[model samples]
Target chain A: MKTYLLKWWQTIRISWSKYTAYRLNFFLQVVGPFLVFFFIKYNLWSSIYGEDTGQLIRGYNFDEMMQYHVWTLVISLLGQGYAAMNLSEDIRLGRISSYLIYPFEFWEFHTAGFLSFQILQIFVSSVTLGLAIFFGFLDLPSTMTLLHGFSFTFFMGFFWFTMQYFTGLLAFWLEETWIMRVLLSIVVSFLSGYIFPLELYPEWLVSGLKFTPFPYMSYFPAKIFMGVETNFMMGYAVLAFWMAVFAFVNHLIWKKGMRLYTAAGM
Target chain B: MSNKVIEVTNLTKQFKSYKKKPGIKGSIQSFFNREYTTKKAVHDFNLEINKGEIIGLLGPNGAGKTTLMKMFTGIIVPSAGELTINGHRPWERKKDFKKKIALVMGQKSQLWWDIPAMDSFLLLQKFYELSDQEFKTRLDYMAELLGVVDLLHVHVRKLSLGERMKMELMASLLHNPDVIFLDEPTIGLDLVAQENIREFVLDFHKKNGTTIIITSHYMADVQALCKRLVLIFDGTKAYDGPLEKFEKILGNEKTVSFSFSEEIGGCDFIDKYDAKWNECRNHVDIRVPEEELREVSKKILDLYPVIEFNTEKMPIERVMKTLMTNPEVLRQQRENLSS
Candidate 1:
């Protein structure tokens, strides 16, 4: 609808103000990781062979590893671009209850909000990531890749990002979700391939990851950039399977959670 | 066409409340004890509201007023009941249903707290998916009516309470909802702010026949805007009737107050007249017996040089406090918890 497009545009116009409200924090957020990743990649390459040498292992020579780390670091910026709070916060603060009185469906409104934030995140993070990559502090094997790796990353990010949303459902029942948040980091680091690449992991872990969506978010796409793209059809198959799994699981939890959700003050 | 826009049958809500023990040890023990409490928040309540009707839901704290509103909005599921709004079940939360309803709470803000109100309005436009012409027309009208067009550019956080409330009214009415839920919309605001909102609400109803269901601890809100009231005392429908009937039944008899220049103890005239009285440092306050207030006031004025005197009745706040806490009423209230 023309109205809908106008509305979406209006939503983004104020995003600059929201983003600028925490300019210092946002800039620091980008730069902090930028510096850390640069040092880590440099140290990794040097430590692999000798002080003067480059490369990590057999397949990944010094040049390749250096490039890979730089690229991955830029990629990691996408994840941090997200500004999200648990869905439970909406319930806890009575915002969800207010939304209910409106004519719109709850999930539809939430989806709109989610889509809005994601668009904003992608825009802001891409700028930051591009800058980081341009500075030559971080590098990844490009292979002149256009949409190959990027497109896969997009699907993987969506599939895994939804998992975070479902995890938001846990807040309905749990008095405190601190433990869940901590454990979530481990899951993200493990499967999203933040700490280690999927190929570098033990064979059993890599195989096991295939069953979950986390690797699609971080690891699979990282490999694609390293010239290790999966079979396109197989990748789509796995992506579709994870999407279905996440959707089914999320729907199930949401249906059950609504019955139990007080949407009242905690 | 029938005037009724809201209909309900035996509406009930029961929320699960997890009990907590005091200390860490008690918490561990409770895990083993497996204790939980189920609170019956709203019970078997039935009502029919016509379009253009503004009804007040009056209760003390935790009286299930908010819960009832939430149910109508389809935010909270009722434990057992049937509720329909404009012929649609509220819980279905259909697009038509959403377009016709709006909710606002005074204590909580729907406006994005950090951004200017205009920004928040823009987001609301998307949520409601209003056409540009429709959005602009409504925005202009609401701003004109509420006198908040200039204020829109200011951040909501920077605005005063009254300004924020004005903006809130505009935001809620952006879609021109046919049904409005006001949960303490005037709470914690100054008298001026309260009056402004009340005026806007009354005018809104007059113009659009928007059925309004308002809950507030402030009885003035009810007194000024609502003719019929549903009083929920302790999570149950304690009283449901006309405002005049509620006042008459709940002993809405006027109480006169006077402040003497000195610390005067008890009033002998009050004793003689059998009038209930309170004396605290230079003030002699009396709850005028239903029939004898004016006659007694005359005699008092003749007897003592009353430094300050008013024949006005006691405030609604005091009336409800006494009604809820009195010993005889408390016993009766508990027995008929929900009917």
Candidate 2:
């Protein structure tokens, strides 16, 4: 446990240094999504309400609609690296081989590394979120009220990170991993409500998606921030269950895959 | 007392199949029916290495030298072998097993590429939980022994091949493992650098009394550091014994060539010396047993026909080639060729 803590501390140190060194790119990663969604919001509103459309949107003024878009963008930050395919890269380069030889559990290293990267993400996301708050562009509740929303996002982020690692390990079995990643992206995009609200889905589809690990990735975070009228407790329970399942499944696959790990060399 | 630091009884590892053939048709067909090909990499290997002994594993490519090394290091499991290293089954990956040994591959650098090599050394120091004083003492000792003190501050990518290798050797030894597995330590090094490494390995073994297992393409490394070697071919042991005995089994015979000024060769002269006229113009080749080489060379020079001549030890390449194919050699050494 002491070694594990030390290693995690080291990983955080490295990531913190990397984040500071590449400050501009880290900032751009957060801000880039805001700009993207702003235009997307403008286009959607113009289509629905016409040229004379007031800043009002979805029955709210232009500010409200823009705020919704920005909220969704900030929520989407939780899903970014989960879909980035870092583990698949590790598998190809045989970087994972180094972990296999060590005494630590592979998942422990993955989690610690992810946590460090997420530590950096917190700063980047906060800046973007802070900007929205400053411009009166987002409706953040008082610190006490937003605490519930923050916890919801943190657990969901943790769950999604584990699931993402499990999905990436599938690259060991797949020949061309892009196909699997695309299929996963489509599922997450539609089911988790990255593009739209989960409530927008029909009754059966929304219920079915509630069973998937994807909602813990994007939908719950969005719901928390937007104060989407739903059972937050229900979402958290479902996220916890999926996290346990992903952990169990990841353990099973890793145990089986190790028997097949034909390490690359002459 | 434990007489052996490493003991094995028929250790074998057969890798399972997981990579599917590409194509839509094949993928669909294989969804219902799966095929597996188990490659038995290390097969029925048995040996007992005592403490402080140096063992050399020799083989052609794909002869399972590395497979044995990996199994010993706990990186891979054996399919059908009972082995113990430092009273532990290596595959168990116990902290004790990890602390007892370090594995180094010649062409691979475990040093962090972007950072100074000392950082990696420091990490390993922390990893092994060495005390600050102990770490410094061992670090200084290894750096001095391996001649890498000057290269510690340089990034691994900036160091030359020899300098990086020296650093690697120093890093692995920093923990003072009871055993060290070197897979091709002298590869990609010049003759001088190879000699330096060879000398370090020998002196390290003598000083630390650490058992060593080295697999390399350079036979000179084996001849210099290891008196005994285990030769594996096609995933099985071909020969195991002292270097001189293996060389004798190899029949280190020599072929001497004499270049005559004139192509006028006669059978009368050839028969006296038992020389054969090879395809070379004005060149006569003679095969002499290693013991009789001196007498034959003296007699050949005394003959009037000789113009210029040179005697050389048989090349190891040809000797191994002949040894692998010789019916007599196989009959004497009844080891299976395919594991």
Candidate 3:
């Protein structure tokens, strides 16, 4: 256990160095996308609420809706991409052989790499949040809400990581996973409340999304921060279940995939 | 605690690759009726490696050197037969099994491309569960030997290929693995770098008694480090024995090259000796038996005003070309010689 922890810590240190190596690129990556989305969300929401100041669309006032947009944007900026892409690239290009010779397991190594990346993301998100507050685009949440929101957001981020990992593992069999990548983007954007609030969707659409893990990644965390009544335990339960499912499936796929790997091109 | 660290018997790995037809209709037809061909990458291979031995795996491209190495390293499973490294089934992939082995692929890198070499070394140290003192001692020793102690902080991407390869060696050896697998470790290095790596490998093995297996296109690497050679051709073992024994079977042939002081028309002596002439360099080469090298040189000197004359072992490229084209004749020669 101590060895594993040491390995994880070293992974973070290495990844942190890589993240900070290109300081200009790292800062621009976060700031550039955050600015673009902030303006778009702010403009779209202002146009909607400008025509009807008294309208209570989906139980959100103008201030509350703006708050949702800011936090949601923050969470999206800090989100992890499908690491399976890296995994697949490694396998297809024969780099996986290097890892196979090591004492560490494949999934564990990639997971440590992903975790290290998120550690950097969390740091970036904090800086972005500070920027948002300074720019007068976001008001600080209450102490209690901040605690609940961070906890939920952490699990939400993990859930998304697992899902992305599971989806990326398809590269073990399929040579090309771009279609799946595109599909994931469409599904997450439409269902994870990244583009719009889940409350804006119809009753049937919301009901269908409840069966998936997308909304737990973005919507519930935002709703919890607003101090709105959410089924916190239930959301946690679903996230935990998906995490378990993805873990088991990933293990099986890895075992089976090891047999299929050709380590092409030496 | 056997002296033999690796043992294999009848090991074979077969890869199934499907043919891709051209155009949409061909693709559809092929998809429906997939024509998969089974490529036998490693065919009934057998090997036994002892402690403190450096063995060279020699072969042409796509001749199963890398595949066999992959199987030994537990990257891919063999379709049939048995393999054991350090008394562990390679495909089982036990942590203890992996802890004892290191693989350095020349075409690929294990270091983090965007991070400093030191960072990758630190991660490897933790992954190998080494104490800080042990890690530091090993890293310092290897870095000093490879002359990369100061370059450790430089990003791997920014380093030269040879520099990165040095770091790779340091990273692989930090844990003192019992068995080291090197696949073309000197692929793209200059002569000086290659010799440095060769000397380092010899020094490291001398100190540590690590069993080593290396594959390379450069014969200098094989000649410098490996006493034993495993020659594979067409995905099968063509020859396995000491380097001296294999050379003896090829009749101890040497390439004798000559350069005349002035360009001359083709001489009857050249035709009589069946020499190959390079008109551009005013050079001529003749194949001579090792026993007759002195006589041949003397005769050539007497005939022509020779400015330069040298005798070299048959080039490994030529050796491999002959082996690939006439495996049966080589095998017969070996059998006859042994008998």
| Clashes per candidate, residues 3 or more apart or on different chains | 11, 7, 0
lDDT of 2 by residue, A1-266 (tens): 77656755654554344345445776677687666755776577657766664754335555555655666566556435553366766665555655555444556656766777677667667777887788667767667446766677778777777677777888667634777877876877777777665655678877777777676667676656666534777777888898898889988987886666665642
TM-score for each of the candidates: 0.88, 0.84, 0.94
lDDT of 1 at A79: 43
TM-score of chain B of each: 0.86, 0.85, 0.92
Q: Can you write out model 2's per-residue Cα lDDT over B1-339, one digit (the tens) per residue?
A: 987999999888887664466899788767877887788888788898888888889887787998888888877778887999989998787877788798777866666676678877776675666778988998888788777888888778889999899888877787789999998988899998999999988888888899999998887888788878788877877778777776656454677777776664465644555577766447777777788788877875776467889864435445566765663575455543343
Instruction: Name the candidate that leads on TM-score.
Output: 3
Q: Model 2's CAPRI class?
A: acceptable
Please state the error at residue B239 of candidate 2 in Å. 0.8
Question: Compared with the true structure, what per-residue lDDT tens digits does model 1 show for residues A1-266?
Answer: 77655554655555546655667876776466656766775676666667634444746666656655655655555542343353557755656666665544455555555555556556655665666568764453454663677666666556655666666667777745557766886777766667656667788977877766666666566667767675656666787787788788889987887788776661
List, residue by residue over B1-339, the lDDT tens digit for candidate 1.
787889988999997766877999888987888678988999888888988788998877788888888888877788898998888887877878888888887878877777889888877877787877988998888788778879888878899988998888889988889889898999889998898889888988887878999998878888899989887766667677787766655454666777666665655766554354454456655767678766878887777767888865425566577676763574465466554
> Best-fitting candidate, measured by DockQ?
3
Candidate 3 stretches greater than 4 Å from native = A78-85, A135-138, B262-272, B277-283, B302-304, B313-317, B334-339
Docking class of 1: medium
Instruction: lDDT for model 3, please.
Output: 0.83
TM-score (C-alpha, index-matched) for candidate 3 = 0.94
